[model samples]
Target: ARNGFVVNGALLLDHDEDKLANVLPRPNAVTNRPWAVLGVLNGDYPRLHICDRTVTFGRSPDCVVQLDDVHISHKHCTIERDGNNGSALVVNHSSNGTYVNSRRIEGTATLSEGDDVVLLFDRIDGAMHGKALLGQQRVVDGRGYPVLVGYRVISVNLLA
Candidate 1:
């Protein structure tokens, strides 16, 4: 909470680090913690959790986070915590490709606290990254566009 500013959906990195934009959110008490997002594509995880073990995302049922949409490959990618630090890495190899902070990854990408992981990708004339609620479209902005309808989470007080 007393770290960075919570802009769109996640934390904002540019604000003064000495002052907090808001308070931290209390956990929902669910095993599903942070980083298990992409909820809009398949109603899976608007909110995600990054346990010690590696979590997989794809169209297959075996994936920890399975997305049913055809755009997703049978076995797309994996998100594992990068040590005890509050950071992660995404390994992607989907047919349609996975987006990290709105940029397509060649093979892998490092994920920070405020980064976004997008599964359903369309034509990206140009793109911008912003925090989004679950994975819903209108849910969040698309590449080259501003999507403005989501329940952004800054803290318990900022949840819409």
Candidate 2:
């Protein structure tokens, strides 16, 4: 049973305090709760990066630098949720491109847990750590439906 989610950087450096510091704070704070954060260490720089409610284009967090010279333009991008089981924060590519796990996604796509999402613009890609399942889904069926029953579980994973 999982109660909380956290995203952390995978890169390990003995002296890199910034890397060790939790970047999820801002995202979590803006979102008004604790969430899972994905830590990215190596990859092409993304043009548009979404941290919670903030979007960073052609720029990295104050303490962090772009991994490479590649830059992505931030335009015509949006995030949406899929059905009741899946969710996605998507980028609508105009002239540039958006890639998820090396595959270029056009229009819309559902983001999974631990997916490498990148928005490409000007050869630079903004990297994002996708966090999923911040909370559980509780369905309360009060009559109407046939074979309806009531039960409670200590774990969200087991509810499904």
Candidate 3:
């Protein structure tokens, strides 16, 4: 005689501030509702909530998710709100590249619920800071080649 039922998975709950922020766009206005949350598959970082129309992740301070991975480019990849359906779109803009579900992306990809995403890097150039020099082989064109760094997006939830 069990009093409770078994739930297969864990559910993480967080507010989407960006959706609330969009309501008034005023600097003084404070919105606490979050549109979506990205749970990291294997990392110490806390869950990421979608707090902007376009959320960027990379080594650069300008990026929303400023990862300290040497292999990551300055402006690696972006999660943007799709204009047609308000869905979240994952786009790769990194020299190292971005992967969704173990498959490398060509241009843009629509994210499905519980889809796996990985930020890939072959070699690291600390100087690039996420921006590779303009070339095919794509070297940092600076000093200090660092180690490889990558991130995996374990789960994604879109709420709008």
| Best model per lDDT | 3
lDDT of each: 0.45, 0.32, 0.51
Q: Find the 10 residues in a row with the least total lDDT in model 3.
A: 1-10
Candidate 3 is scored at a TM of 0.58
For all candidates, the clash counts are 10, 19, 10
Candidate 2 lowest-lDDT run of ten: 145-154
Error of 1 at 144 (Å): 5.5
Model 1 regions lying over 4 Å from their true place = 1-46, 84-86, 122-137, 142-160
**Root-mean-square deviation per candidate:** 12.4, 16.3, 13.8
Query: Which pairs, if any, clash in model 1?
Result: 9-131, 33-48, 33-49, 34-48, 36-48, 40-135, 40-136, 46-134, 136-139, 141-147
Candidate 1 or 2, higher lDDT? 1
> TM-scores across all candidates?
0.52, 0.37, 0.58
Winner by TM-score = 3
Per residue, candidate 3 scores C-alpha lDDT tens digits across 27-135 of 3211244455665543333455554667777777666565566666888888766766867688898877887765679889988766666674333343425443223
Q: What would the per-residue lDDT of candidate 2 be over residues 40-155, giving only the tens digit for each residue?
A: 32211112222343222222332122122234332433343333542444545435555555456787655555455444321113332232121343222112111111111111
Cα lDDT tens digits for candidate 1, 15-91: 23222213222232223344333223212223432333366667676665555556668888876555555345778
